[model samples]
Target: MGSIDKYIFKTTLASFALVLVSLTGVIWITQALRGIDLMTSQGQTILTFLGITGLVIPALVLIIAPIALMIAISHTLNKLATDSEIIVMNAAGFSPIRLFRPFFLATCVVAALVAFIGAYLAPDGMRRIKQWDAEITADVLTNILQPGRFAQLDQNLTIRIRERLPGGVLGGVFVDDRRDPQERVTIIADHGTVQKTDRGSYLVLYDGNLQRFEVGKRDPALVAFARYAFDMSKFSQGRDVTLGIRERYLWELMWPDEEDKTYQQLSGQFFAELHDRFMAPIYPFAFAALTFAFLGAPRTTRQSRNFSIGGSVFAVFGLRMVGFACSVMAVKTPLAALVQYLMLFGGIGVGVWMIVGGVVVEPPPRLMEAINRNNERIARLFRRPATA
Candidate 1:
């Protein structure tokens, strides 16, 4: 790249980085505040919360990068115009289209990064977050079974533990299992322990008393047991993690059978997403051209630089909102397919018109000089008014 190209690229990138960081900070703060109660209630550690929050950054960048690029490009160009650098380039016969090339390249690089995250990395991260949450929940529930207390796992099962051993063994254990409607089983064990094996988990009791009550029976049978086992496999299955929409890759969404509604949405979303991924890279170029159209007029001492820059920035934001709204609506309707093209080619057309069609009329530098000279003369006349 040439010196001018390098300068423009660096300035635009620095501005884009600042905007991205500011926006991400705001988003993170909002999310953390909203989930603080849930996090505290679940005893989630700070490291786990941070891990989940970190995974969310890529998704935020995918949404925020385009708008950031647009603002950054516009601001960078406006600064150049204010500093008279744009005037020098104009004098050197470098057209606005040529000046926009560097910004366009930068946007392409950012777009590629966004695509990498949106397509693969973000989904994988989301899956990991879900899995981590499920494991934490399982651990919390299992730890709730305390010694010397009547611990109720559910309405159907109640357990009382006299003592707990260092190896997760319980002595003087009593369990009332009411899962079967036809019969209720009561078990008292001198010793028992929670064991996980290939077949699944079990609570094995040694030197236990087993009492079975059968419906319509004359007498309840009580049997003394040397060893008995109660299956605890259900708890593990209850916490089994299932993948959702954010967990699946783009291709998986594209070929959904009948099993996943998330996949169906993914299929629809992918079309719009793909269009956006490619279209977003060119926004910096469009923004650069728009800035040139709005602010590349001859330098005027009378014009307030801040007002001009603010107006250009406002226009950039408005255009971006329109594009985002249109893209969202199009994703669900047939209109999205065409809207992608409209936003892309329409932006390009505007840029081309501003650069090549001579529609953006630069103010005559001589006119500005004349205005300044006339203002000075008017001031001089006012100062001499006492002679009248």
Candidate 2:
């Protein structure tokens, strides 16, 4: 690569990195806010809250990288034009293909990043999210024991505490077990804590009494005890982590087990996910080409570039939206997947042709005139009345 190419490549890559981080951070904050219960109501630590929320980042980047790349390409191209660098390069016989090399290289890097995240990292994060969430919920339900609320740990089991004390002690503990239909057992304790043994989890209560009522007997029996261990193993049972189609790794999607229940039920979704991963990497390249085709042509300062910039943004997002629609439909109609490929490659092919042909894309003169008229009216609204 020439010096100029290296400069453009570095500039675009840096801009992409900045935009990706800013966008991801903003969106992640929004998602993380929804999980604030992990720390507030769930009795979890801040680290635990952040860890669970951070798991969604890989998936976010997989969706955001192509858009960021487009923004970065547009920024770089506009910067060059603003400084008259593109005009100079054009006058010096620098073909659009030569100018495009650096942008393509930057896009290649972003595309590879997207591919890796989609194929492995994103799904891995999702799997970990499920596992961590299950473990946290079980821990909270069985161990943490929320205060002042009757927590339904199981369909037939409920527990509550008046207050949580330091050193993992629960005060004024209440346990109601109705798992046995033939009898009902209620236990009241002054203090208690959940303990795990080799056998399983147990709620060990201090200074408690248990009252039991059998199905055949009308009278209830009360047993007083200094200490007792109530088996909580049933309430703390681990949930089966069932991942959705978006949570499956690329290999899992590509070679899905026919006998797998999810695969059997959502076979079309499996197909869509597989093709979506395959197409993820291609979007960055197509977006870069399209942005370049719209704005890379040299133009004098007298000519406006806003229309071209808007056109590129619209084209990039429109194509992506179509691809998304195709993905959704592809879940039912397998052939719908082909439309994305056509749109993607068609954009790339046309973009490359326009770039090489030095096509200066602009809106129709009548449209520009109407836009100018609207702009003048809006500007008049904002303008200050001549210093009265």
lDDT of 1 by residue, 1-388 (tens): 9988999889888999999899988987787676553344443456666777677777677677777776787678768867888778878988766776787777767777766776787777778878876765564224565667887776888888776554345768899989889999999999887666888778889998899999999788999989888887776554678787557666655555656655555666655655555555555555555665565554544455654466566666766777787668756775765765676567667756766654444346796689889999999988884653
RMSD of each: 8.9, 5.1
Q: In model 1, how many backbone clashes occur?
A: 1
lDDT of 2 by residue, 37-102 (tens): 776566566778889999999999999999999999999998999899999998999999889999
Q: Against the hidden true structure, what lDDT does model 2 obtain?
A: 0.90
Instruction: Give the winner by TM-score.
Output: 2
Q: Which stretches of model 1 miss by more than 4 angstroms? A: 138-151, 155-234, 239-246, 254-292, 296-301, 305-311, 357-388
Backbone clashes in model 2, listed as residue pairs = none
Error at 103, model 1, angstroms: 1.8
lDDT of 1: 0.70
TM-score of each: 0.65, 0.82
